[model samples]
Target: MTRTPRGEAPDVGVPAHLAEHMTVAEQHDWIAGFLRRHPVSRRSALRRGSGVVAAMGLASAPWTLAACASAASAPVSVVGRHLSFGDDPLRSMAMAGELTAPPQGRVVVDLGQNGSFGATLPVEVRRLVSQVPQADGSIRASDQYFVHALATGLQPGQGYDYRFRLADGTTTDTATFHTAPRQPTSPWSFTAFADQGVDMVPPSGLSGFTNAYYKPDDTRRTMTPSTSMVDRIAATRPAFHLLAGDICYADPSGEGEPVKSTGTSKSPSGFDSFDPTVWTTYFGLIERSAASTPWMFATGNHDMEALYDDNTARGALHGYGGHAARLDLPRTGPSACPSVYSMRYGNVGVISVDANDLSMEIPTNAGYSGGSQVAWLRQTLLQWRAAGSGIDFVVAFFHHCAYATSSTHASDAGVRAAVAPLFDEFSVDLALQGHNHQYERSNPIRAGRSTTQVPDGGTARPETDGTTYVCVGSGGRPRYSWQPGEVDRYRGNPAPQGDVNVVSYQAVGASAKVPDAVDWSQARYLDYAYVTVDVVPPPGPGQVTTMTLRTITDTGVEIDRVTLERRAR
Candidate 1:
């Protein structure tokens, strides 16, 4: 079971006939062809081919009925439709402000202020186009819609009120955002989470794992879906929001099931094809928090859904074009994947990498970053640690966990073998990850193993300690159960198999090895939660900078909390 570029499990299971030498694209095509030639007929098989027509709202006319019937008889493209971020001018008219990197004179750059783009008065607003993949493997361009952003300039620790100008020249309600303090002495805070896109289907009465669609009522809301978990995060009013990936499950719908459309009537089955409007809905859900703070994103596997071609989506690593065009992110790393970049807020230097390039779990765009990215990461960390860099704490975040213990998705060996060593060498304070759908934290780890356990609410000095890796993937997705005997093992059980120190596999068959248990795993929780890191200043000069990290469930419960300190260089 080879991995994909996104560092998750391979999209499709192993084939009956091993095609070890085939490229991912070749394998993908071969599987599709095989499935077509030998179609698997099921109860809802009638709508398998023609679901796309009804999903696109083309089933309204009488003549379309004939077309739909004919389509239902043939093999239909099950790839779904999406709504445009700029579909409505009025909807797009809201602006969120973020501070620039250089501590400029009241300037607001893109997310994390990693780039330089001068802001002038009387900014011109124009319509933005969002691209969608069609059923026939073609690109469908949405109508252009515009949003006007007003930059009032900015000041350290200052709250600025702003409004968005609609395409028709109307203005949106005022929203306010606060800038981070200019110096490292000032304390700051931020939030991080991943995999919060809600795509549940209406339940069908059945039994077993394939029985019912897991659609919760809140997931189907028109606005501010509960699954978004943005409301609670907004209440904290963090300096920015770090989305590690799978922000929207806009990929194929039904979670590894065939596309089935119930009828042209009411709501489609919970297991319907993809819906592009999920993007529109997702943005609305996250608006409150994002509009108030910088919302930085790292592309996950789901974000790389280039239905027509790899580059169709936006951001680095063959990401979604629409997702990239919608946000104002820093363009510092390789131009091919702008999502990989660095930023500084107070004493924290945040570096985001594109794991899709090296991920064997999602091979759609494997080798996209090549070796240049890891080289860049090494250099970025070295620069931050240098004198006069003003970065006291180095935090790196991306999709795919380097060290995690969830039964649903284990640690990505590629990430651990390639990236973890660099992080340890650079004395990175914290490594944040998602895609496991659970919350797990590791002790300060060096050389692929933990030297000692960092207790909950404990403080670790990075200068002498290794890097701490945390998986905060429970941002509103269904929780993944832990490995067997995880509870007893995490509670200091000494048995080998029952120990929680291992990053087990979801891979099938033999030839898999159970490496020595990872003594670094200190905490594990199976709940829907997010992490908030508060950067606190040291009490004296030459002292360490401290960061308080807390994992809070959606219900406001603090599940796990820890503090990390980085001594002055």
Candidate 2:
């Protein structure tokens, strides 16, 4: 029984005629045929050792194949573990293990628990590979250990397989993963959501919280652990995760505490000082999904606490001041104010701004004045226009909103006054916000007013070269009810409370029946949902890009969808 370079178990069952120099595709086909002829049963002893090899007649006896195959099978137990992004491709893999080759690729043997344990693991191109370190502190060993290898510049849109070798001169395990599509036109889809905090607890004894408000009715809702929300979201297998804000309730020390509404006495330390353990729990539940895809975050009030020195800044008061500086975001703005940035993908430009920075005032009792963030926004928009960047679609996301109907959080009049004009000036197509905890959508509006007001249950305003606002804060956090008469559009009735509204939209632009609006709707209801934005490019030049927003429920159901088009200015 001859072994492969990676030292995997010898292919004893493989016929001698087909054993040499077969391509990967041919090897796969050969394996398929062999499996069909000899159906291996899980309960059969064949999997243990030579029992199956002896039946195949590949060796004089099971013992003969074991001596030759043990060396190869020894390494099969090691596999790839965690993979990440690194600045230098060569140096990146070095942290994991030694380099088989510097320029092209290298291999790291992680015999530690974090390394691959003879299981199938994925490897993607351009990703920094990691695995458990070797336990014996040596690369060579027959012991079951984990190993991770790193490779770079693999072609995109292609699938590749990797094999790990053991010190006993045998290959251990094999696994496969696909590279991301190279071009924008490649087929792909992603998921987006906001306000998924770690402290949210549903009502008890319920399969899922049905009350619109977050109040728990039974032990089930209360017992449904906050981390499970991450697991639920991961089951979707989305290409990416978009967190609107409040990822960790780092400020509040204990669980189930009302976020932010508590007085200064309850506030925690600075943001960095806040325990990362909360985030660890949150990530632990969803690492399976997050490891495969990128997570893009938009700052909410909770994230901004660290930046402020005032009483309101308590509870891990580290705002967006330098938040984005540490992240691997696709885009970042001026260094003076690093939190605000914009990145354009395909025809869409997603602008993430620090609304908290815009709210800061002088230390003394001084009058209100906008900060550098405001100036940066103006300059960024102007630069895009000056460059004649044909941005067909614009989506701006922040913590606060110009319009909100949630009773829990009143409309942030200050945010509306500060950012509304800038959005109008730039003709931003869509504005997404959280922090209100309720679900609300506004008519296409510019400046401080709506362009057109449709009647109740009527369709959204037509494309008019203006921006449409969406409040999607109900991402499994405590919900809040809307104040009476504060919102022009209100729709809550038969409120059994304890339920959070999950809103969805799509870009089809087709007419549909609208549900009865909720009046006195509290945004505090516990709910888990996401918004999907699909940009359908037009058939020809001078055509509009159709934008559809879909609100998906926890059960993979799309409850609501809205569509819009980019009107020619």
- How would you encode candidate 1's per-residue C-alpha lDDT over 177-292 as one tens digit per residue? 65555664667788898877753321111111111223343222223223436887778777778889777664334253322333332224333233333444455556666666
TM-score of 2: 0.54
Question: How many clashes (backbone N, Cα, C below 3 Å) per candidate?
Answer: 26, 86
What candidate 2 gets wrong by more than 4 Å, as runs, is: 1-183, 186-188, 199-213, 217-239, 252-274, 305-327, 360-370, 385-390, 453-465, 485-527, 567-569
Q: If candidate 2 were superposed on the true structure by all CA atoms, what would the RMSD be?
A: 20.7
TM-score of 1: 0.72
Model 2 residue 42 CA deviation (Å) reads 51
Cα lDDT of model 2 overall? 0.41
Worst 10 residues of 2 by lDDT: 132-141
* Estimated TM-score for each candidate: 0.72, 0.54
Q: For residues 1-569, what per-residue lDDT tens digits would candidate 2 score against the true structure?
A: 21111111122122323433332224334544544554433223112222111111222212111222433332222211223222221122211111111112223332222233433323222211111011111110011111234445445444444454443444533333344433345323445666665543111100112234356542223333334445555565543456666554433332312112111222233111122122323443344455444456666545532211111211111233223222344335645433456765445666776554442111110011236667777887776655446556677787765655554444555566667888888777777887666556666666545566432233443335467777777666665554443322223323443322223211111122122232212222234456666666554456555667666545454545666676322
lDDT of 1: 0.55
Query: Which candidate comes out best when scored by lDDT?
Result: 1
